[model samples]
Target: MKKILILMLMAASFAAHADSFVKGADVGWLPQMEATGYKFRNAQGKEEDCLQILKDLGINTIRLRTWVNPSDDSASGHNSKDETVAMAVRAQKMGMRVMLNFHYSDSWADPQQQRKPAAWANHDFPQLLKDVYSYTYDVMQAMKQAGVTPEWVQVGNETRTGMIYPEGHTDNWPQLAQLINQGYDAIKAVSPASKVVLHLDRGHDNKWFRTWFDNAKAHGARYDVIGLSYYPYWLDGRPDYTLSINDLAANMNDMAARYGKEVMVVEVGGEDSQPQNTYDMLMAVQQKVRAVPDHKGLGVIYWEPQGARSWSHYELSAWGADGRPTKAMEAFRAR
Candidate 1:
């Protein structure tokens, strides 16, 4: 009887997640934005909850990032674990699934800068690993207590050269792997159902991903999903050049075939002024991702769909000068 019940529960879990296409938005700074008196509006210019605005446009998932110990002002420091929980609770209440992104830094932890948290600045390799695990576990526990079960958890955000600074740089692949695995272990221990995502900055550069993942895999790092950040405008005029929709699709399909793991464009955005172009680009991204074999492409997430009203000062968001979502949001329903 016990075995039968266990199997039934497992089946139920699978059923709940089967064939899910995550139309997600990353509002990691929403708390900060709201605290600073930012308000959102719908097409009618009527005030609306930011989450409601996204849901109305077909977004089903919320991706939020947490900071270890942000020392910025109250609004800026809202990325803390406790603060993340509060935001996640709100998103969950709207029937939205959560994707907890751990930046692993006090401020921004991205490819260009992965500074060691001030508290761990002097820690040795082993101690740093422990800190990573502890921070991840504590945050997951907090979210659980808040009744927010993250559907996906990112170990590190835009970890192109790895996280936690020089110690985990590309040359120190082993150290990076250890840090990532520690985070992965903590999330699985606390929320086994949550998928772990290893994120990087470039969605079109398959070679960069191959080399990074190969190194991580060699060092025993494990993850269930590969998260990519694609910002075409930023890539323009770069040596490698930006990808068209077809290029993005090819790269994503290749990654799926090569790694055999599900993937998501965990971060994507374009110039807010070019809403029509933004809509077309995102529409292409969606269709291409869905074309991956066996549906390995989970979905694309707009980094900050709440830019109107000048929240966060992001110029690439899908919001308009009128404090309403632009045509860029139509990509989700473009099919």
Candidate 2:
């Protein structure tokens, strides 16, 4: 009886030290994977679902991207509202937290492009805000009906400038804040506990984040979390970042102190050439996040570690050519 009690106490202590850190992955390609003849193999070389493989890696959260009525065969079309709910239900069944990413576009939305959905292309800024609010509310309502409440809802994906292009850009900060507030309010009305994230790429630049958030705060934009995208391999190529990994960690710390909001690496990837290097990058990012004052740095997420050379044509996947995840994924192991 004494031994059992000791073991129970140890488990509880470990849980308390861990503090609900999120090790997440964005597998937006899951449905399309099912459509193809591909199979994700586990460490034991047995055919397994991609998500199950991720769960085995100790990934506690799943992030899925959704589009605004994309046409069939488009990248965004594969991840419709039904697909988002399906993905969320699968993650929830595995006892994993979920993050819903609303791209607010019919196609890919990123720092380089933020096209207004064709259906709303003609709408003025005021009408656009209403559309954004309705779309966000509707998605949350559907997820709730499916018995899945997202732990986080991203208002937009990689919005370095502003969303909806010509209509709403950095030049017009007030309109941008209004549009973001609409989405923030919608998510709150549906799932009060679900934290809203304002996402941007470039995880290493402190100056850009300060400027952006300063503008956001002044214009009445509110959010619970700050989402960053860090691609170590792609960092040097971008003139704006040009930062080393150490710089990335410093940026995270500065964000926590400056914004007083939780920070997360919503998207990250490493080169597959050296699994150890990938592992190091993951650990490096995780350490910076966990080191944030007051535990506001949430965690790091691998963007598409399973996509590989499959349908996504993404080369940064941690999976080996032999159909198994490399040892790098073991970086997710609690230290």
Candidate 3:
């Protein structure tokens, strides 16, 4: 009896010292805006209503994407700068920390497409970097002015390729690092305490991360956190939850140790298109990550949970269409 009691006490003690990590969600640009009755979703839900749902699910952070000019029909009408700021304010009022994602384009900026902003279409390399810095600073200052200082800032979204288009490609990490540093400097200039995250995809590819981060470090790019995007369906042939989770935890630890910075699974989600499997995979990943040494595991943020609302113009698959607790959410909480 004494032996069992002592073992239980030890377990409790270890749990207390383990790093407290955040479980977050990105509301996606359009749906969130529509939820505010800004554009679509005529009878929009109140911001507090959505936040209350998240809070009930134990989510602590909110990520909002900002576009330069979303009014152009040729581009996907995502949240404009003002819309993003409004969301940030609402999130702050709900007691959620905000993560600002700079798309740096009038539309979606991802590995496949990174269309440059209209005003920056003709700017040269030096001028482009200047614009990046100024835009970043101005956004940060605006958020601060609204009393919604972002807790974290992503310089660019899914920048496995790069942002600002032709000049900021990943292969040219040297020049890209300089542009990223300019943004980092601007963030620090406005909010010295805010953490600047350099985001990338291909989280399972350890070699890709090693090479990319090593180059960024060598180029003296300053950033406070390392962010990764892990989508099992897209990367791995099928949803192999266990293997992907183990790989992600190991990769996160390896990168944190190698780069000497806290690592965040900034973006992670299973295909809502395959709800059951997606939930299972996400849960598996969360459980595996929880077992990793506390110091190395930052937290996991679901890319979008309420995507089924049909507000997003991207036509991506959503897991919440059935109005059920996704396996991913169940698995995440289980961890």
Candidate 4:
């Protein structure tokens, strides 16, 4: 009888999670932007807390990236463990769900570069695995201490070619899977309720996702969510969302069906210069994600939508030069 009750409670928890559609944004740059006097304004051009402005725009989830032993560079650094915990606590205080992205490096970890942190650079393969687990566990423990339990946790950032390179590159699937599992296990150890995400870039490319995930599965990579980064403007030769929207929808559907896991556009954005087009693109992207059967399509998250171009000089942000959110952000209001 006790065992039956425990199973029912677990099922209820999962049902609650599935029913919540996440409208999120990765605002890892918020702290630095604010520190440098970057202001965020609502529709009326009135200064407001950035998170409050985002929450008003229907963002229920906030994603922040953490780097290992990062510098204090305004643009390239400052996502250290303590700062991340502080940010997570702030977001949670505002009644927002948190998603922590572990970059596993002292800097960016993307498809083009996945350098190991200087501290871990000298570690052997086995030590590297232990480093991954220990770092992940420590940060997660910090969040727990700060009263922030992230709803989702990414093992690595945009690891299309794999992460912690040299040893954990995609070419070395066995080692890569070990590194991934170390993070996964550590996350579960700290926050068992948090869904672990294995992220990749190019959400519309079905072939690449199939190849990568198939390898992960064969090598026993454990994760509950498949995270994708969709940037229409970044696609070569197909720089328009119209050209790839359908493809992204198809890929999301296929990922859910093939891997039997929840799918999320963990990162997405449009050109800030084209507000209307970006707004339309965002609406269409959300539509496609919601269209996925069985609610397997978790939701879409705009990457740094509030990282105004004037401050970050990032073209894909959804903020204007005047420190106000562009019309593109209104797409989230539909949620």
Q: Candidate 2 or 3, higher TM-score?
A: 2
**Which residue runs of candidate 3 sit more than 4 Å off their true CA positions?**
1-20, 30-48, 72-75, 291-294, 309-319, 322-327
- Candidate 3, residue 174: how far the Cα is off, in Å: 2.4
lDDT of each: 0.85, 0.85, 0.74, 0.94
State the lDDT of candidate 3 residue by residue for 248-315, as single tens digits: 77787888778888778888876665667776766666665555554556677887665654444332
Q: Give the per-residue Cα lDDT of candidate 4 at 183.
A: 99
Q: Rank the candidates by lDDT, best first.
A: 4, 2, 1, 3
Query: Which ten-residue region of model 3 has the weakest summed lDDT?
Result: 38-47
Worst 10 residues of 1 by lDDT: 236-245
Best by TM-score: 4
**Least well predicted 10-residue stretch by lDDT in candidate 2:** 236-245
In candidate 2, the residue pairs with backbone N, CA or C atoms under 3 Å apart (3 or more residues apart, or in different chains) clash, namely none
Better of 1 and 2 by lDDT: 2
Clashing pairs in 1: none
The reply for model 4, stretches above 4 Å from the true place, is 1-19
Q: Write the per-residue lDDT of candidate 2 for residues 1-335, one digit (tens) a residue.
A: 99999999989975764758889989887777777767889999999988889998989999999998777772446788988899899999998999999999987899889998899989987899999999999999999999999999999899889887876687899899999999999999999999999988887877888889999989999999999999867765742222466777787788888878899999988877678888877887788788888778788888878876645666787888777888879999856
Cα TM-score of candidate 4: 0.94
Assess every candidate by TM-score: 0.91, 0.93, 0.85, 0.94
Is candidate 1 or 2 superior in TM-score? 2
